[model samples]
Target: MATAGKAVVAQQQTNLPFAYRQYSAAELKEALRKMYLIRRFEEGAEDAYMRGLIHGTMHLSIGQEASAVGICMPLSEDDQITSTHRGHGHCIAKGADVKRMFAEFFGKTTGYCKGRGGSMHIADVAKGNLGANGIVAGGIPIAVGAALSAKKLRTGKVVVSFFGDGANNEGAFHEALNMASIWSLPVVFVCENNGYGMSTSIERSTAVRSVADRAAAYGMPGVVVDGNNFSAVAEASQAALARARRGEGPTLIESKTYRYRGHSKSDRNRYRTKEEIEDWMTNRDPIALFEAELVELGIIDQAGIEAVREAVRKEIVEGIEFAKESPMPDMADRERYVYTEAA
Candidate 1:
């Protein structure tokens, strides 16, 4: 696989959208479908949030769909992942039920966490997703713990930890990496460096030029991938996952991506310029790039793309309706799952 910088240059030079030669036409179609689903789902969630249907603020993964789908596609259902606050795409890509996710957003009793986890705390233990964390780097230690469990039990499964560049600066990130490395745990630390942490640009907060550089200190391969390119992310993830399953230890993958939305609903995006956002939105959109690739490669036509879009739109509509129809948790049941009872 090419280095991150090289991959970017290669994509630009070749004017090719993606390097998905290994994917069959049907698989590519499904990948595009999932990306579209994530896009539409996040858009629908934001609309619900604005209309007061969603109870709390949500961090949308509008532009980083490829980073989520590409990484998860290579793994089996038994493998696990820990997600970040901006993790709706991760959950969806890992096979989350959109209706239930919408229910969770609506704070209904039928939702994940029985509607208690809200946007950031969603988890599907049966899906092998530990949870989406609210605190920065909070899930890293949890992922390491899961990896330790897998190692001790000899489950032969790998755990992936997804965090942002900002989380790399946290104490939990360091501690977890150290312990995982020493114990040769089956985990992959994926850092989604989306140019900024909250409102502050990475250049202002991070001392190193690349987050992957830090992986060398832990004695594992550190790879950087063009996060917008699905093929790049998949290739890097496949390597890291192989290493983890082989009992070699953890690997750190830095997917260099960007989020189109402000850090959250409250952010006015005063830190970045409209030009920069436009550049990424118009030119480097992961969905647009992959769509163009699929069309150009004769894998999918305009009609195919429209079919996928229409289907995704209908799915989002049904999901929202499901959330609207679902019942909210009753007052008596409020404390049921909040804490451990006397059993």
Candidate 2:
């Protein structure tokens, strides 16, 4: 009877999802909170932009919250990431301050880049978010360089480069992956395949069926996960991180996610059908899916979920207010950070 009970317990433990089995209840709850924060932050940014409080346009990662949070779940504060134009979720996932993010949108000196980076160039170096790049595949090589540095210095740090599917075809992408593989750099290339890159779909652009398949050419592990499912992404991430930490070559993770909003604020979104958009939003929302799992696992109740939502709402409100009240960069200092100052 004892042996039978042990087998049953082992089977039950094996059946639990990677995240549920690996993380504490508090950690899982915190991951849920970060997902909420990402969703609410983007929505708040959209509202502020519409109100003319934010000057430049912003790319919102409204639906792909799980990919960002899950991929970063296993990473340490000392680890690094390079983000794309659609990188707000990545920033929040890597522990960026929402108030500073909002301030950057408002072009305030209190922003991450001191009002220089704005939407697509926010960088928190101390927290290891190298920066978000506006150029396609621009951050890929930078991440490779950072990874090389880590390997050379024996830092034991892993780097994640988050780019869209469109960047997969770029020359830099291929070159960076090839270099990372040859050197066995501690890096993970994350392709957040959100179906459309600007207006063209992946089918219309890339020849490959899936981005992960491309990893074989570079001689690394290629993983595909349902980006909406937090557990799946986290599972893949945990494995990839372990591989990199063991000094194995880089891994490629293709997160099959969808962005509910247009590619950018200026995007007309005429390429995809509204039915498709509604379907993803209604059925496969990352936040909703994660919440359901949390409840099913007995990790959190409805009241706890509502409390998280309320906290995010309050945080978003306070962050926007902070940005609104912050001082903009002085005109006299326009050329301050433009050129390196002499010692």
**TM-scores for all predictions:** 0.93, 0.96
Local accuracy by lDDT, each model: 0.89, 0.93
* Clashes (candidate 2): 0
Colliding pairs, model 1: none
For 171-259, candidate 1 gives per-residue lDDT tens digits of 99999999999999999999999999999889998888999999987888889999999988987888898889889999999999999
Tens digit per residue, CA lDDT, model 2, 1-343: 1123232212334677777667777788999999999999999999998988888788999999999999999899999999999999999999999999999999999999999999999888889999999999999999999999999999999999999999998999999999999999999999999998899999999999999999999999899999999989988988888899999979999999999999888988899999999999999999999899889877799999999999999999999999999998999998998789998
Model 2 ranges with Cα > 4 A deviation: 1-12
| Residue 288 error, candidate 1, Å | 0.6
Root-mean-square deviation (CA) per prediction: 4.8, 3.8
- What is the alpha-carbon lDDT of model 2 when measured against the actual structure? 0.93
Q: Which lDDT value does model 1 have at 166?
A: 96
